[model samples]
Target: MKFARSLAIGVVSALALSAPAMAQDDASSSGPTTNWTGPYIGGSLGYTWQPNTDREKNERIGFDTNNDGNFGDTVSTIGGANAFSPGFCRGFAKGGSAADGCRGDRDGKVGWAVHAGYDMQMGSLVVGGVIEGGRSLVSNSVSGFSTTPAAYVMTRKLDWNAAARLRAGFAVPTGTLIYATGGVAYGKFENAFNTTNTFNTFTESNRKEHDWGWVAGGGVEQKVSDNFSIGVLYKYTRFNPNDYRVTAGQGTPPSLTNPFVITPSGSTTFARTNDRFVTQDVRVTASFRF
Candidate 1:
């Protein structure tokens, strides 16, 4: 009986110790997945490269040579006549123009952003909403002869952008995620001109306004720690046309010295005005989750 009792006690003790060990083994085999739930806010800095296809499409602004001071003519543009690609000059019905504006090589630039989002985590999927704002280092302008009082100089600039996006990702067992995202985007555009055409040389500028559109992209993100993650993403964005056309005849100061100099003549307005702003962004991202 004593021997039997000792054997039973040893078996019971062995089971008690082994129970914990078995539990541990099961946990290790299953492993822990990265939890991508809740809210997060992060900042990212990256290089952005864009194309100027949209600008090249519509280059002709105006072509009227009839110095009658009437810059109005049949305009061809995306929208209605409110957006003009009209005429300038006097005694001449102008047509045809160059391909692009004076805007220089402004397709690529370095950019940075601040973003925050809330994620809904499922077994293997994550869905979230994020709002972000960043300044794009992309800018370009077109300049040519402004038939104002005298030959004038013109300029335009496109800079900065922002977005609100939705994200959906599939999480792997190793705490890494691959996701796609897209949303509405916003930005600012500005235009200006300087005309010393007449005795009174003057400059005109347009304030940058809100230009809204769409953006889409995808990235691979990995969990670096309990509260931090890192990711690399590629995003593409396209903006609406910010076509700006001006009528010099509307506001022209006649030359006191030369009345026949077509002092009131104007140049063709801008075409699509580089309407399409497309950008490719390669970014490195880091975030902290709460």
Candidate 2:
């Protein structure tokens, strides 16, 4: 996060310093004015941050203790109380005991995208639309610790994403365009599960999904020539929640005498709190205008 902040400050500073020089050049140049109307293709490389990666809550662990097909029956201790009193954590578990804690949180990673758009200049204002596709390596996970002295880990990753947006901005005589953009986005997510509970047979399902969401951001583009431009953009994206399930199969011998038998014999299904996957990106872009 600190690196992202520093990069942003440096880019804004560079743009600030260059604006004056660009304005001076515009004032002295005897050349034709730069036109903002055009079709363009571009690509961007950036660092992505998943700010909520470690924010996990309301995680549930269930079992079907009875031979019946329902998991609503809570797994209870020999004394007839909930067996998950050890609670949950936001990382992978190292061992069966709660005292072992969990592994450290995962970090954000690099992301890249390719885009195409067209712009129309009306007086000093430019309006346009763009489409983009990209991918990121960001991942997150959560773990539930049970009194059985076991850890159940659930993980999710952002696979890929695409967006279509409308852009509107003011173009100065100095060849700089300042713009704001917002639009609909789509993405895919991959999920997986792990556990330290060796006594129970686990079945995992609903491990991947395609979801819809939205994105919004703004950037400054500086035209280096009639056919080329460079810019930096900051965008925030979010996706609808998804579901994943893990079932503890019937214990050996199909009896309560089996420690692995979940009293209800049902699956434990959960979605991230608020069912939202969110990310922020800072990218440096280069474009070819036609």
Candidate 3:
């Protein structure tokens, strides 16, 4: 009887322990829990393309009263140089030449940039900052003449823009990340002119810094395996108040003009009223994270 009782007790105890082991085995067979968290750094290289848009608007109003006895005609103003002058024998002249002279044209170009950033993992989201710089080739042209001041319009080309960014993203899977970023940017512009009299020259070469703007974009990253991944991103950056100034004065050199000749010429003026710039870029990159 005693032997049987001991054997029964042993069997009961064994069954109790085996039941929890079987339950644990059933739960684990479903799958191991996924662990998603870490700090990562990587580098990327890809073709970057950007479209640059720059614009300028200028207007002037003035009435001159003098005894010059001759009045000028209205001319086509291309390139925004609006003015008129008197001919040798006219009190006032009216024609399409003055009205058409001061109008300007707009053009845009594509360019590239290189970038680097860091991502911090929290739950299922990542946040970081990035800095990038690159070369730009974009420009515009405006060709016409002034009737009041009897001048010509010029060309302006903007090149080289850069930016810094702050980024936030989420981890959709073990290695896939999606993000958005925004920050400040800077750029430079060059204005050139080929007058009816002068050769091509730079009226203004503006290198601007401290230009404030915001940028926002998103990117996707996927891991090919444990340590390597690739991504593609796009960003839009607008410079804050990329304002500039230009003064086109002093056209007739006194040393070149004779006092006896009927110099029907007046002053040539081309000034910057206002200017602003905005740009966008897209690139593909590959990175390796450990």
Candidate 4:
């Protein structure tokens, strides 16, 4: 967040300083300069995607194999009979369970946002702040069991999001303004988790929440008329982490390699997950300049 703030300040300051030089250049030209000072409202359409994170952090977003109140059942799977599992996951079987793995993906989707901002134009330089918001239509679901014989799965949706940021641009000889933007962002999300051993299967659906973070990026805007403009903007928004609570019952899955082999008794387990949301967006915007 602090990095975002510093970047915005630096960009705006740089643009403001260049205004004097731009004005000096304008004095030597005879052609009429494009006007860009004013308040404007706009809407945008875009595509959004989320990048995958490190497995260590992702492993933290796990479910409990045992049904007790303890959430220490890490997300690693047990592939073979000799696979080692610490704590309650000891002697856990992995294969033969309905679940094959534990994972999730942040899919891409079509999205849009509305924006309102006031720009201060000085010769060929423009600087301003904008507040805009919209939601991405991406969804992800991961369900599978580790060889540890523990089965687990869950789903999440990156719903509505918004941001307020600073924008700076260099207006060329034509009516086009190439700009850069960065600032703070916020988002709302929905999540659900379900997993269990052969003896215990648990489901936790319907959890909606929100988080705060930052956004940064840029684009180009072109004015076709004094009162209307069209542009494309690209941005990356990062949201704080989200978590959910779940429970798993104990079960002793029979070994596939040896039917006579019995793992152990399943215990009551408690679990929680820490998952963050990040998105990349490419948007085409239409604005009404007042």
Candidate 5:
């Protein structure tokens, strides 16, 4: 009886020590848990492109060619009644008629962004909200050519942008997440004007503005570790046009003896039409979860 009792006690002690080791082995074999529920911070490097098909429209130049006090009066010029018949080229204007063929548009630019968000995982589905801020190097311009053989260039530049977005995703067993996100976006824009006309004086207004719009996109992210992930995303962003205005008037020559030679001597105000700004972005992102 004493021997049997000793053997039973030895077996119980061995099992007690081995229990923890067995549990650990089982956990390791089940694979790493990829719970996406938590807060995360991330950054992205991306290319942004503005794909506007139409050239920038100059409402004032198109409608008020004579620069008269009345917009209804149609005054014909050598370049036709419309002052913008020469059309527009992307970026800044290149002097001469051959260079203004509108052959090239602005190229895509590199952009960067930083974001933070929280996610709640419900089984295979995950939902979250995020806030992000970024900067872009995208710029666009429109040019109008007058009979005086001069170019008037108007430019809009994107300074910075921000967004508040909500996301919904499905988590696959392979530690990959596919998500769609959309939200309200805000942006800052700057406006500028350039003219080759030597006989005109220009005044500008509302050169800078803050505007609001929306953004939508989707992405795929793979968890590299329990607390880290890498992903690729595509987004489309758009904002309402901001008011940028310019008024042009006749300028006196260096020699007051020379009469003001330029046509359309009256003051006229110019504005943009169909000027909503839109951009498409493709980015690679790295994120850390807490």
Candidate 6:
């Protein structure tokens, strides 16, 4: 009887100790209760206002031919009228200009774009890359004409400022992060010439399309549940201005020899006038934690 009782006691003690040990092992095997950290892909929509500094150009052409004092002024112009219309010199009877103001001045128009990229987290530091693209409208003008006392507007169609960016950030909470980013940028400027009388020439060529700049901002991420999280962020970027040349005579003949003498040595420049931009975006992310 004594032996049986002792055996029974030993069995009960072993089970009691084994129960706690099993529970501890299970908790340890589950690992430290860490949040999800790895590669993530997402998209964001936001408002952006990237402005280039206003630029003006003027030149004097001795129009001894038309002494109304209309010396040739070759100012770079963009959006007033399409320089490609046959009726651009004089407004069209149908009511739309053909000359789309090809080579006069550019109008200062605000524009926007979209973005998508991947992010990774290593402890507190976060790094990633993004691909963003969209369209923009920029303007230029030349008013101080030697003879013609009128302001001309030139509008260039900015196709899109597309680029890839590298990001670095910090994890603030169990499900929150903040970061800064920058990278290489590129885009196309649809170079055309237009005027009030003749919609004569249109030229579409890509030039000096690559640039590098820096972007800085902060954002927050939150976990709504185990598999999904939402985040909101704001960023400011300074983009490099691209420079290229738009040569006319590629379209139709002008009423005169040429509006202005073509410069073989002159350069076309697109400057970032007031390029500080702010972007606000909200994104949804899905994840599986180890």
TM-score computed on alpha carbons, candidate 5: 0.77
Which candidate number maximizes TM-score? 2
What is the C-alpha lDDT profile of model 1 across 163-215, one tens digit per residue? 99998999865566779999999877675654433443232324455678899
Cα lDDT tens digits for candidate 5, 1-290: 23323433453444445445544544676543457899999998767887655543322233343556344433344334544445555556676352464334464777899999998999999999999999986877766566556777778888999999999999866566789999999999999988887776788989997899999998877665678877777789999765787776657644322112223554566766546888888777778999
Ranking by lDDT: 2, 5, 4, 1, 3, 6
- What are the lDDT scores of the predictions, listed in order? 0.58, 0.76, 0.45, 0.61, 0.70, 0.39
Scanning candidate 4 in windows of ten residues, the lowest lDDT window is 84-93
Over 1-290, each residue of candidate 4 has an lDDT whose tens digit, in order, gives 33333434554455455545545555665323468889999999767876565532344334344444345544332343422232222112233353333233535677888989999889889999999888776765544443445545455677788889999999875566899999999878776655454554454533776778999999877665668877767798877555555444333453333211222224223333435567777777888999
TM-score of each: 0.65, 0.87, 0.55, 0.66, 0.77, 0.48
lDDT of 3 by residue, 83-155 (tens): 3342211111122345433433333334556665555677886777767776656554434333433334444
In the predicted model 5, the residue pairs found to clash are none
Off by over 4 Å in 3: 1-110, 142-144, 148-156, 197-210, 240-243, 252-269
- What lDDT would candidate 2 get against the real structure? 0.76
Best by lDDT: 2
Model 2 spans > 4 angstroms off: 30-33, 53-74, 253-274
Ranking by TM-score: 2, 5, 4, 1, 3, 6
* Poorest 10 consecutive residues by lDDT, candidate 1: 89-98
